[model samples]
Target: MKIAVIGTGYVGLVSGTCFSEFGHTVTCVDKDAGKIERLHQGIMPIYEPGLDVMVERNTEAGRLFFTTDLKEAMEGAEAVFIAVGTPSRRGDGHADLQYVFAAVEELADYISDYTVIVTKSTVPVGTGAEIIKRLEGKLDEHLYSVASNPEFLREGAAIEDFMRPDRVVVGIDSDRAKAVMSELYRPLFLNETPVVFTNRETSELIKYAANAFLATKISFINEMADMCEKVGADVQQVSKGIGLDNRIGGKFLHAGPGFGGSCFPKDTRAIVHSADDYEVPMKIIRSVIEVNEERKLAMADKVIKACGGSVEGKRIAVLGLTFKPNTDDMRESPSLDIIPALQKAGAEIHAFDPKGMEEAKHMLEDVSFHDEPYSTMEDADATVIITEWNQFRALDFGRMKDLMKSPVLVDLRNIYGKADMTSNGFDYTGIGR
Candidate 1:
């Protein structure tokens, strides 16, 4: 099978490379000449574990290719995957489908034969039908089939998620489109990976519904963490108790600053906007959004209170800037809100993350970024852990104590226990302890 993946961002790059790894010929197309040239030189634009190696191997094997020309990429391709970005629109929370529509309109001129045009981007419901309407006047209905195949890859573990996804959801109205999609994902069938075939709107809703539910779990637990702190109850034990029930699984129950990533914040907002257009109420998700925003801002206050009610003229050390560990993505990270608020309250910020500092530098201001963990804590009044990166899991507490002026630890992720910090002669503050 030959596949043409438009937009070589995270979704397009990872999906195209993995499809080639499965023995299909894939050409990833992008408008950025610099990115395409870098890919040719074995340089990856985004950071994903094991992605560079897979791309190099497939490129060497002549199974993977990158180019700026859509016509060239679509040459002899049976499946053209539109994996473009559908970010939330400013002021209106609706998905800005300009990029998706532009890609479809541009590629229409190059479609020389019957092809499966699949949307691999996370789009709102009815987008597939809209694509069909967009193409009605430009091309014959028999010449192309529009389908929705939303991606479900996590940022850090995208390659593994792509190769070993729990299930594949595809929306198609024709047997021809289904046959092409099945052939494209036939490798996963060997692992008994379930494939859910449904109508286009249902398939689109599935992606939004999954993310909204996970976001609800996060907001629910964070709210519970707030109550736990008020009652001096341990939220960890509470999470465990409810999680042990077969009905309530314990995946997104870890209480932290808030949920923020490329998917959750954007998808939740877009879905709410879509629901409003249809006059459907999304009260729970609306509250989830409001609570998450408040949670991030409140973390700054948490640190301030830990510092004896004031952070004025104080130096605070922060560990982790990305939304989570093992990815360089800084989109919607809690640290984005927390650090700025602390700075506004007259705290000087010193921060470090294993992979996020470079990207974080662009999004953050007036903060000193360090190369290593302990260096970030040097001469700090209080140390806060915003994201629970693995290195911060096992820290040299003795060295940390020696470096800082005051031994105040605010474990927002609750990675350390109160007894452990107290034994080390430090003031410890944790979320819902």
Candidate 2:
């Protein structure tokens, strides 16, 4: 199978590479000449576990290629995936679809034969109909089928999710598009992966709804976290008590410094805005957005409270800056909100992360960044765990205490509980402990 993947961003690159690994001839196209050149020299624009190895293996076997030419990549391909970024628009909070439409217009001009244009980017509902309307006169309308095949890959675990998705959604208005899309994903279908074939609008709505629901879950848990703190109830135990139900799984229930990443913040806002435009109010989603924003800002205040209600002239060590871990994406990370708040309260911040400091360097200003955990805690007044990275789980507690000026710990992630750290000679505080 020959496939053209437009836009070599996170989704496009990983999806295209995985497709090539599955024995498809794939050409990943991007408008950025420098990014294409970097790929030509076996360089990757973003970091994901095992992606570089997979890309190298596919490239060596001639299964995957990178190019800047849209026409050249689309030639003889059965399907073209539009996986461009759909960022949040200013003031309106709608999904900015400029890149997706640009790809469609280019496809209209150069695509010579029947091709399935699948929107792998998460777009608002009715976007498929809009794409079809855009390509009405520019191409053989009968030859192309605009599809809504939204991706649900997490940033850190994208390749695994793509290759072995639990279910694949195919939005099709006709049998021709369904067949093409089905044939295109025949590999996954062979694995008995359930492929739900639905209307275009449903598929688009599924993407937004899933993200919005997950954001709501995070917000609900966050609110619970605060109450747990006030009532002297452990949130971790609270999460487990509720998560035992088969209906409510244990995923995303872990309390932390709110949900902040590229997807949750923007998708929640976009969906809320879309609901507003339709005159159907989603009060829960709007609250989730507000709750998450407040959670990030207030998290630093919790750390200050742990440090005797004032961070004035105090050195605070922060571990982990990426929203979660395993990916260097710094978009809307909790550290961005928490760090600035701490600085304003007169706390001198020292930060450390395994893979996020390069990007975090520009996001945070006037904060000392160290390479290792021990160094970050050196002469620190207090240490705060922001992101629940694995390395921070089992730390040299004695060493951490030794290096800190005040051996105090405020764990926003609840990775370390109160009793254990207190026993270790460090005055410890955790969210909802």
Candidate 3:
């Protein structure tokens, strides 16, 4: 199948590459000439694990292409996937669908044959109907069909998620659209991957609902972590206790600073805004958003308290900058809030992350970036773990103590045990324990 994926962001780039790996000819289109040039030179715009190698292999095999021209990419394409960003609007919290609509308008002008237009971006409900309405006169019913095919890829594990998705949800009313989509995903179908076929609104809502629910779980556990802290209980034990139950799986049950990334924060806000637009109240999700915001700032307070009720003029070493590990994405990271709050309290920030330093440099201010973990902790008053990278799982406590001016450790992800830190001659403060 020939595919044209619009907007070569994370979703578009990964999806196009994976589709090409599945033996489909995919051309990823973007307006940024520099980004397209970078891809042509084998430079990746975003840092995703193993994405560069896969892109190189697919490009070498002539199955993948990148271009700045949408018309050229859309020519003779069986499916055009609108994988542009639907970021939350600046004040309203509603999903800004300007990019999606613009792509559809331009696509209508170029597509010459029967094309399956798929919304691969995470959008609010009724977006598919809006797409159809946008192309009402520009394209006839026989010329194109709109479908919702929301992506469920995680940041660090996007490649794996795309290649071996748990299930694929597609929204389509037309049998023709379904046939085209099925052919596009024939490999997954053959692998017995569950392909959910539903109407467009349901498909759109599925993405928002899934993200919102996961955000709720994270918020719920975080609130539980607070309660456990007050009641002198262990959150990890509580998480494990409930997670063992088949009803409450252990995926998003880990207590942490908060949930912060591209998807959760933006999608939750967008869904809440959508609910408001329809005059429907979503109190739980609204509370989730509020709690998550509070939690991020609260993490900063945890670090300050660990530093003897003050961080004034203190040098604090932070172990991670990215929202999560294994990717260079700093969008809405807990470090964004925590570090700034610490700085506001007169603490000098020193931070290290395996992949996010470059990106963090632009987003953060007055913070020193380090080449390694120990270097970040050099002569620091306290060491805080914001993101749980693999290397931080088993650090040499003796070396860490020797490097730091004070032996204070705040483990927000609960990666280190209380007994272990206390045994190692350090003042350890962890979430809910």
Candidate 4:
């Protein structure tokens, strides 16, 4: 199969590369000539665990290519995926569809034959219908078929999610479109991967609904962690007890600062705004949003209280700045809120992450960033674990104690136990411990 993926951002780049790994010829189109040049030089714009190697292998095999010209990439392509950004609008919280629509308009002019125009971007429901309407006078009806094929890739584990996804959801209004999409994903058929075939609206809504539900899980567990702290119970055992239930298998149940990333925050807000447009209310999702925002802000106070009721004139060491480990995305990270609030309260911030420091430098101001973890903790009053990166899991406790002015630890992700820290001769605070 020949595929052209528009917009070589995270979704488009990973999806296009993986499609090539599936033995399909894929051309990833981006308007940025600099990004395309970087791809040609084997330089990736974003970091994923194994993306660079896969892209290099596929390019060497003549299965993948990158170009800035849509017409050149779309030449003889059977499917063109619109995998552009659909970020949240500034004031309305609705999905900013200008990029998606612009991609559609650009690719519509190059459709010379029967082609499957699939929306691989996370978009609101009814977007597929709008694409069809947008193409009414631009092309012949038989020249193209609009379908919805939303992506469900996680940031750190995108390649694994794409190749071994739990299931694949595709929306089609015609058999011709379904056949093309099925052929495109024929490799997955060997593993008997379940593929959900539904209408366009349902397929689009599935992406948002899945993200919103996961956000709800995070918010629910954070609330449980708060109550556990008040009642002097352990939230980890509480999570384990409920997770053992067959119906409520545990994922995203760990208590943390809050949920922050590209997908959860933006998708939840976009869905809520979409529901409101239809006069439908998403009360639970709205609460989840509110809870997540409040949780990020409250973490600052938690750190302040951990430092003897005041962080004024103190140098606080923070480990982890990205939303989660294995990715260098600093969008809406809890550290963005926590560090700034601490600075406002007259504390000097020192932070370190395995990969997020370079990006974090742009987002955070007046914070001392170190290359390594222990250096950030040097002479600090207290250490706070915001993102649970693997390196922070097993730290040199003796070194941390030696370097810190006072041995105080606030384990927000519950990666360290209260008893262990206390035994190590340090004051420790964990979420709902």
Give the residue spans of candidate 4 off by over 4 A: none
**Root-mean-square deviation of each candidate, in angstroms?**
0.7, 1.0, 0.8, 0.7
lDDT of 1 by residue, 1-433 (tens): 9999999999999999999999999999999999999999999998899999999999999999999999999999999999999999989999999999999999999898999999999999999999999998899888999999989999889999999998999999999999999999999998899999998999999999999999999999999999999999999998999998989989899999999989999999999999998999999999999999999999999999999999999999999999998889999999999999999999999999999999999999999999998998889999999999899999999999999999999999999999988999999999888
TM-score of every prediction relative to native: 0.99, 0.98, 0.99, 0.99
The lDDT for every candidate, in the order shown, is 0.95, 0.91, 0.94, 0.94
TM-score, structure 3 vs. true: 0.99
Per-residue alpha-carbon lDDT of candidate 3 for residues 306-371, written as tens digits (9 for 90 to 100): 999999999999999999998999999999999999999999999999999999999999999999
Worst 10-residue lDDT window, candidate 1: 243-252
TM-score of 2: 0.98
Candidate 2 whole-model C-alpha lDDT, 0 to 1: 0.91
> What is the TM-score of candidate 1?
0.99
Candidate 4 clash figure, as a count: 0
Model 4 lDDT per residue over 1-433, tens place? 9999999999999999999999999999998999999999999998899999999999999999999989999999999999999998999999999999999888889999999999999999999999999999999999999899999999999999999999999999999999999998899988999999999999999999999999999999999999999999999999999999978878888999999989999999999999999999999999999999999989999999999999999999999999999999998999999999999999999889988888899999998988899998889999999999999999989999999999999998999988899999889989987
lDDT score, candidate 3: 0.94
